[model samples]
Target: MTERILKPGSTLGVLGGGQLGMMFTEAARRMGYGVAVWDPDADAPAHRIATHSFIAPFSDVNVRDRFARIADAVTLEWENVPAELCEWLERGCPMRPSGAVLRVIQDRIEQKQFLSSRHLSVPAFSIVESALQLRSAVDRLGLPAVCKTARSGYDGKGQWVLRDASDVKQVEHILRTANAGRRWILEQFVEYVRELSVLVVRGGNGAQCVYPVVENRHERGILRETLVPASIPLDVAETATEISKQVVTALQGVGVFCVELFQTTNGSLLINEIAPRPHNSGHYTLNVCTVSQFEQQVRATCGLPLGETRLLSPAVMVNLIGEEVQAVTSGEGLYALHATAGAVLHLYGKRIMRPGRKMGHVTFTASQVETATETARQFIARIRRSS
Candidate 1:
């Protein structure tokens, strides 16, 4: 296939019209490009911003062709979109990161295998195909292990942690009720010092750029905060950058990739997972980096030059979840954070609200990450008080 560079007026097609798609469309539109999005929801956030919105199922042939017909290149904000649909679009227009990349990344088992094939470090994992396999994997991996669905699980959904032998019954019940007749992976839980993520973008020409490492904090398996230029040893950050580049290179596709890593107490890094799109942790880049991760995604997919990822300041990002959204709507102190200096708020126009659902995020820049984090904490405390 010949490489083609898309000009400013070219149309970009996006799959999955969620907040990520909305942000990607915003970036593309800002750079004089047009965006067409295909998603089932008519009220999706991206629909309000995209140049064209196909409100139909991903498998609908007409909707798929309409997207491909108008797009010079197609990319996705989420990995769970049907791989067959992506492959079909590939025949009509270029698909960034490729359908093959989606197939490998959409499944936890395949992702781990790919990492292992590249000699990358990952936790011990076993695939469970049946009740017998689940029990055996739990017994082998021991207590405090996590049982996760092999596919379609995110933000702690479709996951159960087993801390003791007695938890086995609860795990079995969850498996039967929540994931009946589906494949799962049992992984040995890592007692990590901190969680880190590297956002790397690789272009069609094999050129790549790495964003500064960000340390993440999760509440109940959902990302809550991210601190850029993670307060780790310089050598450790360098190592993570190199590892993230290797993962993107191995993917053999063009687009932004988010590699989540676990920093163990022994100071070693292990691959936790990979997302082939602009990630939640990379949200700080929109405020503190020379170029946002969403813009980098558009640049890489369109065969444009990868943007600078130099951090403009020490930054912290706080996720405004559904619970916080409720508080803010009720005239709680959560809305008072809008007055915070050096803070930038981005609210996704999502109507539905539920516990743990991501509604938006706020980023704060400061001379030091500690100061930025403290300011974010104050806002979080205010929101918590209302809850």
Candidate 2:
């Protein structure tokens, strides 16, 4: 089949201005494509580097039209860019991954139901409104469950883990956690040994590509590290890849799609979440693989074939949140991070250093995942020292 053109010098419009968008802009720039992004934050990471930035609400049709006029095509850094805005813009220009896919993923309830409809196994979950409904859901799903806001939750924010009925009393606090115009979703906790992620890139012509599985680690509910070529059995790893493909076909999605799953002791995999962008888990690909997720995102959105997903060596990626960076109090602490072997530090140009805000990341590759992991861990001590 003949392919469409996504030649160099093409201008791409991105919808959000977070780090993912920043990285995407960097990749596009490297490939000789001009990038433009629309975000409200003047200091947003992506906006800092974009060739053109419209500092306005994504919901504004005029901004969308302006982006359409300036850019050859449209894409987004994250999934929550109000598909309505994309839909409104699509009438003016092409937007990748389709509004259909975005609509299902924008809401957690719809995302979970879409997975279930495709015969994918996800954690036991219930959607609740009132506190009484939450208590009833907990009663059915059991204690020790997690309640996550159905929309606008990410980076371990907007979640509550309840050990028992007493947790129901905190519903008001949970409700207030999300910005207005969102609701909470309750999910039964799964006893899993590890969390894994797979990223798939589908071209405009329906051509597809896949990346290797990555195991993720979390601290205090926030993602802390990701290890490439996960230690799971080969069969399990392949299974994860297959499950990810299932999600891709189910969503009828094009461009990079991320599937987060939990692997149980009984050799089962269950869906955890989905992200239709350059994901945090795929950060290791920047150095470990021949093609990084950011590159793949642009390639797929531009209707090009996917690239290699091979790993040259074991790799680990560490997230540097604002809270963690602020805790680094001295020059010595900052120097330690720069000194780590094989470390590639990517700092988002976000001006705010608020607690729990994702600031940047460090990645390293080695022949040994465990040793690489330990080396990455040593930075925590330095962080503590600086704090």
Candidate 3:
């Protein structure tokens, strides 16, 4: 079947209204497409700029029906959005990535199993339905393993690292007191050399474009910075790229996807996780790439031709977490950041800020990677001192 191409002026529906959705909405609007954002939070950033907005729970059948009636094509900014909702939307129009894809990627156990079954390299993991299962899995995977909820966790939430017997006992007790039938995953810990990620955009026609591999640094499991063109051997980069493309193609996914990987001490790569939408690490594309991940998402969703993934410059993307946003939004810090050459600041426009919440990001671009890296380091240090 020929894919239906949604032309400009047609309304595009996005399932979540966070920063990713807001950016996708901006990109669609720039390309002459109207955007309808559906997020339960009325204060979600995308809701403010959306041409149409649906502020209702995903379980609300009435809102789902109304959204299905108006949207020409549908995509999502968050994987946690109910797969059933995507399945319902699919009956009306194209749902990029589809509900089936979500069901696989949203659950840690299922995602690991799918990748492992495909012979793709992934961390050793076992499913946990109860504390007893957790202990059994730990006996196999051993200490220092990580335990995470099978669903609905991001940016360090719903996770624990069991480094010793005490940690294991505490986590087991936490699990024991939790709701019945809830699932978790125990993964063998990887002492990786560096964290790396690649963004892949696949179209309905099976054509794909991959952005440059990037190195990521995390602070307490939250992404602190991303360095474009990860400083790895050419062979390693090629392998990472190949693995990411293979994963997305195997899923039959038709949207922007981010594959997180761990480069172990042995120089082999292990799949960490996958995100089915534009990722924080790819934010550098906003300033350095010919087409940002958000724009690629719009194109893939609308069946439009995918854009070029050319890198315009080396860049460092630093996320503004929680109170860090205050340092850059006003006063001398804001002025200093604005004055820095090749630096671009993007604020998410979220109303409330709390610890660990992602508020915005800054992208620093330069002709040389070292220059961008040094400038970003200096800026980060300055902010830390102020905070």
Best by TM-score: 3
Better of 1 and 3 by TM-score: 3
Clashes of 3: 0
Q: Estimate each model's TM-score.
A: 0.96, 0.94, 0.99
TM-score of candidate 1 relative to the true fold: 0.96
Query: Which lDDT tens digits does candidate 1 get at residues 122-240?
Result: 99999987767789998788878988989997999888888887777777766666546689899999999999999999888898899999999999989999998799999999999
TM-score of 3: 0.99
lDDT of 2 at 333: 58
What ranges in model 1 sit over 4 Å off? 177-181, 326-335
Q: After superposing candidate 2 on the true structure, give the runs of residues whose Cα lies further than 4 Å from its correct spot.
A: 1-3, 172-182, 326-330
Query: Lowest-scoring 10 consecutive residues by lDDT in candidate 2?
Result: 325-334
Candidate number of the best lDDT: 3
Task: State the displacement of the C-alpha of residue 324, model 2, in Å, after optimal TM-score superposition.
Answer: 2.9
Clashing pairs in 3: none
Q: Write model 3 residue lDDT over 160-201, tens digit each, in one string.
A: 999999999999999999998799999999999999999999
Candidate rank order under lDDT:
3, 1, 2
Clashes of 1: 0
Candidate 1 overall Cα lDDT vs. reference? 0.89
Over the stretch 162-255, how does candidate 2's per-residue lDDT look in tens digits? 8755676776556646365566789998899999999888777777788888899998777889988788889998889999998998887878
